[model samples]
Target: MSNPQEPYQPVQPAAWPAEPAGQPGNPGQHGAPPLPGNPPHGAPGQYGAPGQYSSDGPFGLPGQEPPVRNRRKPWTILGVVVGVLLLAAVGVLILVNVVNGATNHARGLADGFTKLVIAGDSSKAYDDYLDPALHEQLTKEEFIAGIKTLKMDRTCKPAYNQVNASTENGTKAADVAGLITCDGDKKIDLAYRFEGTDELRMINIKLKPQA
Candidate 1:
């Protein structure tokens, strides 16, 4: 007969709980979902983590646009202003030249008339300022007779002395005064009218001897 309380037989170990079908072992701790392309444990066709598009995705962060600047226009405007001023200056020069030329012409006419009258060539002097009525009415001899009546003293000799000239629009006139000495006896003042042109004409001669 064996002892019923004999030494306990060696006990067998209990079974471990079976790992769940889809859940991987170590991955359960992190609680992260698996990505597409990266390998799960090193098998070729197994699950892999998702990949990046060239290092990162298309939807990145925020940014801004560029700025605009001002442009230059002063040279163009300055050129126009200078051109107008030059034109005005040229116009003024032309006007002044015209006025000066007219004045010189008038003065020259007065001098010519004085010279003609003082020379005592009354025929030439009278003809220079021809009056139609006198030319028509008087014979050439009668014109000489009329001029002789003035009794100009031609002794000490007559000389044109001074002339004053003036003008209006295109019309010009001058007053010429002179000294005449008659045969060394007395001095006279002579006055005459001068009409303007290249051919100056004399009119209205007056002579008065000094007392």
Candidate 2:
């Protein structure tokens, strides 16, 4: 009669449980023997034989499922931050260029007016921003006489500040501010109307602390 404790044979590959240890011709005790050339479970370096690698090792052979890869979340975030800084730097450069252009233009206008006033040709300087109606009525000689007779000397230049431009109805104006130091510390605010390019028609003038 056959032995009563005979081991059950594996019907298919899935039917095999883990084999037990230390048996001759079967390297295992109570389960189906390991398939030919396959390593015994839990043996030293048994899972990866010579010229073979475990799934966990880098550069494993094809057809083997890849191990889960660790993501570098901090490095990804650092790259995004660097990109944003570059974009912000570029934006600041553009803004600075625009502001510089506007400042240079205003300075040129102020300088031109200063030169005209120094030469006792305040009328011509005044014409740059004058409206057509005002230009027709104001004579050039009248402007030259008034400032000259008032002893307005070219001792100090006008300190232009707070320059701005605005529009009202159909008229546009450039508000030029400066200290007109004719005798003492006095401020002169002039709103020069914009007639055309490089043409500022004086629409309003206010002299504070009359000296």
Candidate 3:
């Protein structure tokens, strides 16, 4: 009643209630700082456990950075794949060249030896064409006599139907079979096995007239 008459004084507001001691949200008593290793009031604090990491990162928590990805891994894998393909291509090319080379070598040996035998040069043909193992089986004279017996010495150009080569147990071998036209319009079927690769040597031969 006395205050209302004396200039109508305004009433002061009540102070806020103090937070309880040891409570997490508030600072210490008298607005002091929080203890060591403790976080500020109302802070979210660290999201994950210490020393814990994820490979599949881009951590879900806000404001956190993910682990750096290995940028070179994909490129490394690509390089390896390309290298394998190139090596395979090289291998196939080498194999094809080897097969073709063997064929050509066998053909040259056959043609040269056949020409020598037909021209009646038995000494040169036997020494150059026949394998050493074959020399043990037949003398040079016997081989030339056999050729005369078959009348192959009168033959001309050959038309080979099959000429194939293979490598087995580290040994290269080839087979050639074809028809040869004789001087009298007669035909002879001739087959031969040539051994070795770089310098072919004939191991066997067979000749027969058309049936």
Candidate 4:
């Protein structure tokens, strides 16, 4: 038998199959597979750098735009409410001023009419201050005759107590009440009615014994 114990021969190991290109064991090769629809390493594709993922997509896929929000709805409603409140407040202030002005005007007119009567100028009062309808019912001579019997003191000033205004049949009207000090310190309660805003005219006057 061929020398049974011949010198030992070490068999050379078979070379590992050449590692495929881009595989883990191949140091000089890129091992990872190229991303689909993306450029190879070192060249820019749809993005700025190679092998770099885009933040605009999920897992390197195309991204969708975020949904829009209606950010102005709450602010719009708030603005509308604020505007309405402001307008309402302004309207209330204007109404208060108008009422006050009307009341003061009525008071002045009452004072003037009382002064004329105390001075025994009924003819002038009837012609200038009396309403047309009232003048028609009572003649100027009749008005002077009615006041002639009263003992009025021309020196004492007339004092107004209350003045109130209202809306009557779509017309602005007022009623003024006061006392007139006359001869011998006697007092008489006088009430006057006035109508119209721009051209206030005395509609009636009544004198009563003070209680």
Report per-prediction Cα RMSD to one decimal.
Answer: 15.9, 14.0, 10.5, 10.1
- The regions of model 4 sitting more than 4 angstroms off are 1-14, 17-71, 168-170, 182-184, 196-198
Count of clashes in candidate 3: 0
- Cα lDDT of model 3 by residue, 87-164, tens digit: 999999999999998888777777777778667787898998899999999898898787777565454667787889
Across 80-114, the per-residue lDDT of candidate 2 in tens digits comes to: 99999999999999987866665556556766866
Supply the global lDDT for candidate 1. 0.59
Where is model 2 poorest over a 10-residue stretch in terms of lDDT?
188-197
Could you tell me every candidate's TM-score relative to the true structure? 0.39, 0.54, 0.60, 0.62
Ranking by TM-score: 4, 3, 2, 1
Q: What is the alpha-carbon lDDT of model 4 when measured against the actual structure?
A: 0.80
Better model by TM-score, 1 or 2? Answer: 2
**Which scores better on TM-score, 3 or 4?**
4
Off by over 4 Å in 3: 1-60, 64-71, 150-155, 196-199
lDDT values for all models? 0.59, 0.60, 0.78, 0.80
Worst 10 residues of 3 by lDDT: 48-57
- Cα deviation at 50, candidate 2, in Å, is 20
Could you tell me the TM-score of candidate 4? 0.62
Winning model by TM-score:
4
- Steric clash count of candidate 1: 8
